[model samples]
Target: MKRSKKRIIKTIVFEILLIISSLLIFAPILLAIIMSIQPPEFVFSYPPKFLPRGFFVQNYIDAFKIVPFARMILNSALISIFITLGKLFTGSLSGYAYANFSFKGSKITFYVLFATLFIPAEIVLIVPLFRIISRLGWTNTYWAMTIPFLASATNTFLMQQHFKTIPKEFEDAARIDGATPMQYFTKVLLPLSRPIIAGAAIINFTYAWNMYLWPMIVAMEDRMKTVQVAINMIMNAESSNNWGIIMAATVVALLPTLILFFALQDLFVKSLVGSGVKG
Candidate 1:
């Protein structure tokens, strides 16, 4: 009877802790939503009203007028799509080679790629990349932003780990059926590795979408500016400091990521767990 009572107490304590943790995690998002709907005049009011006295949806409309948000969204989307496809194709190919092939100095080559992960990207910002891009005449172009990060060591490592799990016999059987290397990879390996690829796609898309520093440096025109850089411009514009509109823009910025997460969150979690296990 005493042990049963203790078990019940433990369960209740765990449930209480879970609720508290969930609330803490969600508080900021909840606050953002509330602030986005609050009246512009009352944004900085004393004690900061948590609930609006009246409904006003004009903030979202004003945000669009203040900036060409639709154009910025389109630019960001195009860049992200190109970057995702580039990284997926190149990273997967390199990973497959590293996993299955045996060649002289292959280990050393992979080590060098892996070593890049340790080097802070900020440290290389001013020198070799600048010289190379300048020489190629890609400055102030989309290519400058999209081409450099087409393949990532982290993606390669993830794919390599996932690829290593497939039994060698699968490849051998494909070869026996007269399947070429490309055919084998496309049909056998890729199909089996969809989860890892999906995870990599999500990571690549988020990185490209939120990328600011590189785009700011490379894109010289207002039309070329990404969503992040444009958001900074919105903050600096001589508007009436309408917090509702600013918050609404922020909420707009967050929607794609939110939608992507909600749509693929289950797949994302499954991929991470499965990748770790396969590795």
Candidate 2:
């Protein structure tokens, strides 16, 4: 009975801690939502108000009117979709080759590729990458944003790990059926890789959607700017002190990634767990 009481007490404490941690993490988002709904006058009123005074939906409306929010949204969505598709295509093929084929210096090649994960592309390679893009006359085009990020070492590494975990029997069965390597890969391996693929897609989409620096550097034209870059346009066009409008734009910008994450969270979790194990 004493041990049972101790366990119950510990569980209660853990639950309380968990709830507190969750609230702390969620506080900023909750505050942002509250601020987005507040009036311009209430935004910075003395003592500050944490609750909504009224449903000021006009802030959301004003966010769109202040800039080409729709166009920027389209640009962001298309760019993110392209990057996600490209990453999946290249990552899967590269991972398949590295995981299944044994060639000269295969291990060395894979190690080199994996080493790129430690390198920060934004800081180190930005200048040279920009130079290359400029030389190609892609500085103001979608290609400038999409091509450089088409392949992700992290995604490739994850794919390779998950592929390695597949049982040899599947490979043997494919061989016995006289299936070509590509056929076997497409028909057999890919079907079983849905979880990881979904997870990787969401990750790539979120990264591309949230990218600000590269898009800002490459896209100077208003029409070419991504949503993240264009969010600043809200502040530039509106009064900088209007926190409600800024928060409204922020909430709008944050929704896509949040929705995608919530929808695919199960697949994402499965991929993380499955990718770490080897057969």
Candidate that scores best on TM-score: 2
TM-score, model 2 to reference: 0.94
True-vs-predicted CA distance for residue 71, candidate 2, Å: 0.8
lDDT of 2 at 171: 90
* C-alpha positional error of residue 26 in candidate 2 after TM-score superposition, expressed in Å: 1.3
- Each prediction's number of clashing residue pairs: 0, 0
**Model 1: per-residue Cα lDDT at residue 59:** 79
lDDT of 1 by residue, 39-123 (tens): 7667888877777666578877877788788778777888888999999999999999999999899999999999989988856
Give candidate 2 misplaced runs (Cα > 4 Å).
Answer: 1-5
